[model samples]
Target: MSVREATPVTASTEPPPPALRASARSRRRRGGQWWVPWLFLAPALVLFLYFKFIPMGQAIVMSVQDVKPYLGSTWVGTANYGEILSSESFRSATWNTILLAIGQTGGSMALGFGLALLVEGQTRKLSFIRSAAFLPVVVPMAVVAELWRIMYHPTSEGLLNQIIGLVGLGPSGFINHPDTSLGSIMLTGIWRGAPYDMMIFLAGLAGIDRGLYEAATVDGASTRKRILHVTLPGLRPVFAILFVLAAVRGFRSFTEVFLLTNGGPNGSTEVVMTLIYKLGLEQNRLGVGSAGAVLLFLATLVLTICVQLLRRRRSA
Candidate 1:
């Protein structure tokens, strides 16, 4: 009698209807099967296998054989490698490549990082400066190289030499003398490349939390101290990317050097890729060129792997 009939026991255990069913945005639909993404990637994978990997494989095979465009390849089993190792041209090319890589990479990174730091602050008004810095990157490198060739004409009327003359320095041998040719090319490479590197650095800098800076300042850190501790540490990942990319770019540099001097001034600018071009395309020593190319690929691969390992270690 005291139970009051229990309201006919009609209560249900189901969840309540959501108050606003349409309020929660739906997740983008994903493929039902795990293989769906692989399917989507098939085209790119096939293209890479065909274009990049196939060519790379062919190059490797050609490196071990005496090869040419019209001539049949004769397998020589490391003879090509042996010849390259013993050749004076290869030695000179290797040395020049090392110097060029070091110079370009160092110069580009230094200038780019400095510019990035200059522009990445909260001051939104300096966008013009950023644009100016990056303009060279967007311009065709061939055009820049051509412009620099005019500026580096190794005479009094050359634009760079004229500017130097204004500063009381006599005419300089910019691209003519062996002593200055590679250095001159390096200047152009660095100047044109720094802006591109700066863009990457800017992106990395933007990802850094302002709160970290505020906290560091609260702890009485100086500007340089904050940069050393917070900014640079935060940019290690970016630095890895930049380093690998710059190294690769340095290794692959062709157009500027090709147009500027064609590895001239007594082969002072004969970097590996340039030497490869001369051997394969100009001299028709396809096997030797392929060997050089293989070396370039190996060098690039090693650099990339080392960078990845370094990043992992730093992050860990």
Candidate 2:
């Protein structure tokens, strides 16, 4: 091989013209101005401050005070939080919230992912099936709640009870009974949310490299092995995203629980949000409600961080 002498890097010893130097200095100054980035971010920052941070501050402040609607407020210094913490209802609500998050997240992810696998990348004849599966997702939550309420009727005439009768079973108290109320509402939530998760999982599955499956098959892997070794590994990101999003959404769940049980049948379905609504709106204990809200916010924040950390660890 022919060898060539390497060129040495040289520094410019001569100074530029004063005007060019000034121009360069100005450019550097402009580049370093911190406010330039903030200028672009100002709108979003203002909205977030107004809508999210400011409200959060207000809630934190309110949590320590006694807030009576129209009657004015008084500083109580953690009394509201103390009262809630000491209350049986508050404890029950917190426990219920945890159970709900677990049940809802697990049920939706399981059912949705299962359904996605079943119909994954099917032919035209199966294309229409996803649309029908997604029908429950489009229905308004209030309507779904009411519909499920009717279906959950304790009497034999109720849809669910009637279906059970067909299987040679007797009528059972679903949402009408305290012991089963939470589970019944959970089923309703799973039914409503599963289709949405299914769509997301289907999208993830579709994006997976098909050749991985082919390769797995050629390696004499069974169907289950293909899913475990090829499919699931490729979907780690999607799983992480869905897990966090679903858990966060589960934290704020109130509608179906409200419409179905309204934290009733002996307060068995009283999740934190419902309790907050009761405190802030119906019972007019805004301070206590705000405290509960703050606790929920913190819980969600912690849960989110934990999930993200878990995802990072798995990825690493």
Candidate 3:
């Protein structure tokens, strides 16, 4: 038997393959260029810092002090908050805000979901219809407010009143009367907001598993049943997202209400934002207004956090 000679094997010291070398170089380059993105973002960041964050910080500071434009602000501690919290008008505004939020959020979501279902197709007719329906969303809020204001004129000659007259309904003082002011504003909000929600819902619907619908249909499920069991479940995340957006939007509603009713008819449509605006700009109660604004910000934050927590729990 011949004896076999064993050779010692040495570890290869060659550089990594071209692909790996290129990846490593790319990562190193990316790491080195981390500041590049910040450089590009500098202009926007500076604008935000000056216009947004600085004002936000100033607001927070002003919330705790009495702000006088010429005389200068004085430290009032928490008195501003106390005053705002105790004001009867503020309390009423808060209540109205909550009611308006609920009405707008619920109405917009329901209407948007229905519209999404109706227009969920790739056909040209459906596309055209969707675009037409979305016009309200794209129209400036001021324009929408003015448009609705005209339609909501208390006179019988008003566009909306004319339609209601055909249905045997008498001309109602829509925004002029306190009884229907808030509701009239809510309808305006819903009409404008539903299209945005519909677009979001259409995107969500596109992401849904079509096979599930097929299977449900194969199982002889009716349209309502399929919507209840499959569609709703599939769009659960979208619903949560929309609910947060709608709630936040409703809570901060100001422009339309300001333009249309201006919290008129005994302050029936007075929302928190309008109240804050009145306190700060109109009445020059900047301290109290800042306090109110802070409270609103906190409320919105809490609402968002609660919604996020609930969504996480539901997802789990």
User: TM-score of each candidate?
Assistant: 0.86, 0.83, 0.95
Better of 1 and 2 by TM-score: 1
| Ordering by lDDT | 3, 2, 1
Alpha-carbon RMSD of each model: 4.6, 6.8, 2.1
Model 1, residue 178: distance off in Å is 0.6
Q: Residue-wise lDDT of candidate 1 within 32-89, one digit each (tens)?
A: 4667789899999999999999999999999999885665768898988888889999
Whole-model alpha-carbon lDDT for candidate 1? 0.88
**How are the candidates ranked when ordered by TM-score, highest leading?**
3, 1, 2
Report, for every candidate in turn, its global Cα lDDT versus the true structure. Answer: 0.88, 0.91, 0.96
* lDDT, model 1, position 84: 87
lDDT of 2 by residue, 61-95 (tens): 99999987788899999898899899999999989
lDDT string, candidate 3, 1-316, tens digits: 9999999999999989999999999999999999999999999999999999999898999999999999988999999999999999999999999999999999999999999999999999999999999999889999999999899988999999999999999999999998999999999999999999999999999999999999999999999999999999999999999999999999999999999989988999999999999999999999999999999999999999999999999878
lDDT of 3 at 18: 98
Report the alpha-carbon TM-score of model 3 versus the true structure.
Answer: 0.95
Assess candidate 3 and give its lDDT.
0.96
Candidate 2 has what TM-score? 0.83
Which residue pairs of candidate 2 clash? none
